[model samples]
Target: MTPSRRAVLAAGATAMAAPALAADPVSLARDERHWARVAALFDSPPPGVIQLENGQFGAMTRATRAAYEQKLARVNRETTLYTRRGALQDVQAVRAKAAAFLGVDVDEIAFTRGGTESMLVLIGGYSRLKPGNAVLYADLDYDSMQVGMESLARLRGVRVVRFALPEPATRQRLIDAYEQALKANPDVRMMLLTHLSHRTGLIPPVKEITALAKARGVDVLLDCGHALGQTEFSLRDMGVEFAGLNLHKWIGSPLGVGLVYIRRDRIRDIEISILAEPSDAIDARVHTGTVSYASVLTVADAFDAHAAIGPAAKARRLQFLRDRWAETLRDHPRIQVLTPPDPSLHAGITSFRITGQTSLGQALELKKTLFERHGIFTVERPGAAKGACIRVSPSFVNTVDHMDALVAALKEIAA
Candidate 1:
């Protein structure tokens, strides 16, 4: 075999030989030494920082980080081999693992750089939209997806209907608003639903909404960017035609890796906007040129990490922290909780606004002050509400003490 072909085969063998099992937690339970090792994988305190802004980016764990480091090092040694065919096998393995976790066939999932790219692919791929037809989204949708819709509207000369969720919405009211929008714009051929809104931390009843849209002949694209690792659900259960999820967030994978799901039958009909390399294959829409193989390969580690920890246990622990802290701040007169207090309506995220505050600058200052003075790090925003407020997202690694520290920071600032 040529040296290049031999190297390619070797890398493929290594990836296939990589263990799929979860890391041993006995080390975590038995020794304080392991805690520091695990903690080092995350952004360390004092310089790197605490990451309550996981809604923005959740860095990888020690296992996934090490896996990427090793893979990248190996790729550096065999660049030609990796660039040719090894990269393909690595990405396929990750995609297959992600599909298994998502409860879909391997062919149903597509690898994308991240959620934004995935959303662009979905919105731009549809051939149905024209001047009179509309794309339906809402106030709660992520800004990136919203921008994609607006840009498409501008470029395609179609109308983009952005709706609102009634303040302090009841479950039925939330569903009704979407239904009403669909009814009003009967010409709406597409709907972009955020399974979990980044700002409000609200999770819509996606299955119900998707079913309603399908019955009306509207194609639905669901964004699970904030929902995937944070909540428990099956993509098959939601029945949406297209969905995108960021693996880095709740799954704790390496950055720049995401999964896009296209319903099995619809793959051929959607044209990818991304220019792909020439290939005789199925679902060419996903084969965008020269993706990062190291990041893609770590997605499997993210899945393993998630499963090993136990989803139900992780969910309960995260939600517990949010609820415990949110309840304490809920009664503050100056605070207006944008997220519903009901646990069923949300997950790890809880966002609110300080009643009198204004500007993202003020919010940012508050976050910095809390970190500097009280040792709590969080995200602040001049959000789509009364005013600026801090947002907190705790992970499975966080403890009740973390919530207590946050509460203390709020009390100090509020006082």
Candidate 2:
């Protein structure tokens, strides 16, 4: 059947009887049969090239996409009636679900368009910086987030301090750099921490870094857009007071669904972006005008599907895929794995550069060569001190055979 018709049939089936949850966690870990069943939940990508760029945007599962379409249809039919009568309650329900998923209080969560929007709201509205106060962000932070911080510095009249993460980073070395920066810039009032670097998939020691910042009287705005659904953790686990997350990335929610969290007591620290009724609630600080009600409402379905597979199981599968390819090419004479092999520091996303090819042109050309010559798709990320490198990010849908193909391509191209 065609994909549209299949989606309609799947929607009807789901409405009649809830689809079963993913296989049990233990079984999912040890049994390929169970993993294959979970993989079947997603629609296969286009036939020609292997898609290993899920970190940029993960396509929704068959169930999630169908549910989103059904919701959109319902909203279009009901029109303003649904918005007037039922939208607020529906949104509140999803907000509560999101809070529970993050182990945060319901009042602390606010939905935004996506990760970039969430970050912009927090960085632009934070109220504590002054003329001489400083803010810090590292090279590994997302490009949009780095821009937001720069805007914040201009608006708040605070100096912006930029730093580079250790080229070959370890958990301790990462913490030490942050601590040294904080100590050196005693006037720094806020720091932006990317829980997982998008450039090279570096998982920093967030809890440790948060603690270090807190001890020095600095507040940390965590950009967890890539961390939330990919790895297992909670708000309490990270000990953070403010954060921005993307459900569309790892949660596999429909595009345009993201969240911002402000601890109940810390709500006063962020200025309200939209002119609305005076309140201290987290939602008051976020002003995403006329968002897609359908996308926000369907987030509950994404949550349901994510929970079914379980975060622990998902983490294992992503790491396994990363390791499968990394280990295969580790000994290649011209290949250098940018992400550290330590499980604590890396996940599915990994980058590598050809020994002598480090320019942006080289990286882009390599990406094109992989797609045209080897039927593989990847992306180039800039700002690495060493040079630009191609990034590969695989999801649960990718298979061992896919990684084997990537390994084979690298072996021939890098040789």
Candidate 3:
């Protein structure tokens, strides 16, 4: 019985240097040797294609994947016997860890199937809207979330106010836009503020906008699908009472895990929408029946791998990878970098368009060309009001060379 190389690496015994967590994090971001050690925690990409489309969901690390598989097997073998015996408590324990990791109280959070489920629960469950009262969301928000907000127009008799966020957005401009929209729609009682836009990797000024909304007697529902692991911030500091988050994106968990957060005082504002399934706690917001126990169980391991890299260090490293290619391509004559130079507005997730390609067809062709001709994998995201673009989200597993390869490919394609 010999251990595999993945097993050895999974145990954290490897040639890669352990993360120098004590070092200045900004500098550590560029310390290739240090990052090389951190990168060793996951297996490399396949032989031909380089994966740059991590924004859809995070691929589990080796250790986390192993734990997920083991738990999955246990669930299959034990069946109802396994889940019936303390699984609720077990799931709640993992929820507590996630809450602590995100700097929130354990009671304030509950696990859902994925970010979309969380969004739907929070939006679909909001109890404060009245007939003619309005809710707001931006064009940059996730498609499913946008639809959920639209549904409230019928479900709760609230008007769904949709706005397009300013492009080449600045912190001040973003705040101003929300302020103007609120001022114009005085009847608006709630707003959906996307903490991070997957389409353009736009991080809005959430706290500032939330404050603005508060001044106008508006409540905000925060969407943190892409913000959790890679972006550095506290939920409290963002000043949102309701939020939907994902574990599979930046948190590096197994698929099918997500979270819902409501400030304790505001819990009653989001009613338990699950018919006949009553709960008074935050869990009241979710009733995902018969979820993947393995995905939820493996959360502790994913949280560990994220913590070992350390939030600050991980944020710095991901931003570093983002800037490596974005900075290089921003000035190119034929390429348009959608994410601005502002560090606060983006993480590792970014999107760009070939100068003349704004239609979905053009973006799709460019994505296909990048994949089939260039061997660089990315996804076409088409929600930005301006037009469609290709998204490049680099995980910590990606190397500087991967970014460089993308830069080279874009240069060739654009030429």
Candidate 4:
């Protein structure tokens, strides 16, 4: 065989079935052999690039892509014949499945284009705030969410209070910070809490902070865009009445799929906007007009892949990949790891900055160097309260080797 063909064959051989499952996902996480097999389930990325910037969205597995294409073809073939007739029923079926996956009431969830759309729906329609009331958010909250809250200030005549969570924060310290903020801003009747900070990949203590907010009578509109599939948690347990979630990120679905969730009792708090059909169903809260039928329907297939590995395993596997590189480089003098070692405070996503290079331009340059010089893809996340950072998110498709490559590249660059 030709040399190139032999190399391709060798690579394909690693895609063999994962060995019998480990007793638990934590143990399974360190088993590179199992992850390599799992990685093979996803169609490969381009040959040369190591895709570590997975926070933006997830890659489709072969099975998911096939299912998506088939759904697409079916939707096209039937056109509005299916959409105008049986589509809502089909969507309801999918909604039931999504609700079960989230452990939420089916009536509480509504589909939207993606997490951003879901956020917009919740922020724009929040009906509880009145003039002179204050809405609080942190620096680590997602950018679009911050903007939404700012717009809410104008629309509702509420005061906007933005604070920065303590860098290098711990579970107790985080809660303390929120408690202090809530006490300091007495008029704060609403707040935004991001389950996972997209900028620094810091998973805050949502439950405890939500408790603090509740004691102060602050209604929380949570931005859970990156948390749903990235971490294993019961959304209800978080005690937030409102949230936005995405299927396209950690869930590995095709893009343009996400949902808005309001606890059943709180549904009345979000005013039914004109975009909706003026119905009481949660689905009527946000209508973007003609969503991609294929993207919505194929969530069933995505959930298949998600459940095959299971949420705990997927989360552990992702954190495993992250830990490998982050732990390795944490001690480097010139490198600063943003996510703390607190296992509860971090998961799949993490961010870091080269010492003293904390500006957006510097972060972009570092990202460019990693991409162009070493063929390792990473993304620069601006708006970190302390500094700009390069965010790294790994999917199940990534293995220890990809992380090792990133470590080696960063070490060389820092040197």
Give the Cα lDDT of each candidate: 0.72, 0.85, 0.86, 0.86
Worst 10 residues of 4 by lDDT: 13-22
The true-structure Cα RMSD of candidate 4 reads 4.4
Can you rank all candidates by TM-score, best first? Answer: 3, 4, 2, 1
Candidate 4: lDDT of 74? 83
**In candidate 3, what are the lDDT values of residues 1-415, reduced to their tens digit?**
1247447646672232245457777998888877777766776878899999988888777877877888888899999898999777788789889888878899999889888999888888888889989989899999999999999988988888898999878889999889989988999998888888889899988889999899899989999999999889988987878999999988888988999999999998888866536767887678877889889989998887777777788888889999999999889999989888899888888899987789999999999999999899999999888899999999877889999999999999999
User: In terms of TM-score, how similar is model 4 to the real structure?
Assistant: 0.94
TM for every model, in the order presented, reads 0.85, 0.93, 0.95, 0.94
Best by TM-score: 3
lDDT for model 1: 0.72
**Ten contiguous residues with the weakest lDDT in model 1:** 12-21
Tens-digit per-residue lDDT, 1-415, candidate 4: 3446434433443333233233488887888877777787777888999999889999876667777877888899999899999988898899999999999989999888889989888888889998989999999999898999999867999899999998878998899989999999999998999999899889989999998899999988889899988998888888879999999999988998999999988888888978666777777788778889899998987887777666787888888888999999989999999988888999989999999998999999999999999998989999877899999988877878899999999999999
Extract clashing residue pairs from model 1: none
The better candidate by lDDT, 1 or 3, is 3
Best of the two (1, 2) by lDDT? 2
Candidate 2 residue 381 Cα shift, in angstroms, is 0.6
